[model samples]
Target: MFIKIIKRTMTIILIIIGLLVISYLLFTNFYPNFGGDIANEQKEVYQKSKQYKDGKFHNTKPVPKDLSFPETLKLAYTFFTTNVPNGRPKEDLKTKKVDSINIANYQGEARMFWFGHSSFLLQMDSKTILLDPMLGKVAAPHPLLGANRFNKEFPLAIEKLPAIDAVIFSHDHYDHLDYGTILKIKDKTKHFYVPLGLGTHLKKWGVHPDKITELDWWQNTVLDGLNLICTPAQHFSGRKFNTSQSTLWCSWVIKSKTENIYFSGDSGYATHFKEIGEQYGPFDLALMECGQYNQMWSDIHMMPEETAQAGLDVKAKKIMPIHWAGFKLALHAWTDPINRVQAKAQELNITLITPKLGEEIIVKDTTNNYPKWWEKY
Candidate 1:
């Protein structure tokens, strides 16, 4: 009887293990590729970059050493279990809608529309530019796996939007580079500007090769009389479990004859900010990352205080905090980021603009009309 009982227990354990293996295989296989493999031509381009080494890209400044297996497990455990208050709002966030006519009618004046988080519709120099546009309902591999966007609907539907002159990508992370959003807008988008090794992803998604332009850090291109330069950021990149830092990550400097704009694509507080300021200072506006930060990975994402300082470092005439009020990617309350950064900006006497989602802010308008929209929630 004892022998029979032991045999049954061992058989049950084996069957359970087999089932788990099958489940994992199915999940990975069926899920989107996120991006496909790097082609030989792209690989040749990557080889020319000074940052590419061994088989992956490296940050200008090194990140904290890789976490030990036990440490990584602990971090994962904490992330899965922690419940952050106000991490998500109880109701859909209020947003203003702009029709396509107004967007296309703007003659030569610079205007910007925020779509929450890091996505923005920037019209400057008579060109329409979309930045880090992840317009999907969820910021994850699948809708069921991650947090939903704060708003149920965007200010304008993708189909109704005016033709896009350019779509600028900061990196390949899911929140910033969404597959569903790209598929919906690709036909209408005229050009795509991405970091090194990222064109492969676009190619896999059916974007024509002629429309894609890949840039390494410090590289600049002239697009419709605007100078679009890829700058450095202290961050990592990967869409899947095993491919971290395979592609470069970057901030952007968009300079025209009349205006200079800096978009701080997700970054930790680093000296690169000062370097950028020296190279391209006194920006008309700087969109700095200010949310989804934790101490464990502080090297990759800046704290609120650091975000304010980054604005100063970039010599921005006006600063606007972004990368918050959209998704709950970290442990802090959803409101914590804006609140803290606003306080710091006030202390530093820095000019900060806190626009409501979907609200259009004329680049030349320096007046403070933005309300504390997040406080009511």
Candidate 2:
């Protein structure tokens, strides 16, 4: 009887394991096209890149990509079990709805609209540009794996957006390169600018090949009246477990005849910031990353203090802290990034702009002030 009982337990265990394997396969492979196919031509182009080697891309500076299996397990365990008090707000955060008509009619003035987190609408030189527009409810492959966005509604839906002159991507991470959001807005966008190997993802998602332009680090392109240069960032990328570092990540430099702007995609404190400043210093404005960071992954994401310093390193006349106030991708309090960066910016005498989500920030206007909207929550 004991032998029979052991046999039954083993059978059930095997059945459960089989079911789990099947579920994972369906989740990753069958749900939808995760991204564009890496075609032979694309692979040949990647092989020519200095950063590509051994079937993957590498950062210019040495950076660790993965933690040990045990450490990853511990992270997952803590993430689910910990009581992250300020990880999310009790009530929905406040936001403004941008007037689409005003945006369409504007001419020659450089302006920006923050749509929470890293996504922004940058109108410069009479052209409308979008940066990492993950305007979706969730920032994961599926809603099951990630929390919904902090705000219940986006300031402007894709249907309501004016014809975008260009859409720029920093990397292939879901938060920065969402699949659903791309599908919805591809028809309305005229062109897409992405780091090396990321155009494949866009191509897979139905963006016309002619409309996509891929650039390596330090490569510049002239679109309309703006000069865009792809710059370096210390980060890794992959949508699935097996494809890590297959795509390059980068920051961006947007220079117009009147203004120079820097967008730090996502990066740790590195000497590249200084190099970029020397090459294109005295930026009129800098959008720096300042959230979702922890000591465990310090080599990839910058701390708040580092964010302030990076702004200075790039010789930015004014700085705005991004990558926070939208999602809880870390263990720290939701308000911690902004609070700490604000203090550090004050100490460093960096001119910081903390705009509320959806608030308009005129690039040339220095006197406009934004309320500390997160304090009430």
Query: What do the candidate models score in CA lDDT, each in turn?
Result: 0.89, 0.89
Candidate 1 residues 1-377, lDDT tens each?
A: 99999999999999999998887667655666467666566667688898987778898777855677689889878877998888888798988998889887767678899999999999998899899998988888888878788987777777788899999999999889998888988999999999997877888889999999989999999998999999999998888655678888999999989888999999999999999999998898999999999998999999999999999999988899999988989999999999999999999999899988888878777787688989887
Ten residues in sequence with the least summed lDDT for candidate 1: 28-37
* Number of backbone collisions per candidate: 0, 1
Give me the candidate number with maximum TM-score.
2
lDDT of 2 at 200: 83
What residue runs in model 1 are displaced by over 4 Å at the alpha carbon? 1-26, 68-70
Model 2 per-residue lDDT tens digits across residues 1-377:
99999999999999999998888777777666467546666677799888888788898877865677688889989877888877887788778988889888889579899998999999999999999998877778888888888888767767799999999999999889998888888999999999998988888778888999999999999997699999999998888766788899999999999989999999888999999999998899999999999998898999999999999999999999999988888889999999999999999999999988888888877873777888898
RMSD of each: 2.2, 1.9
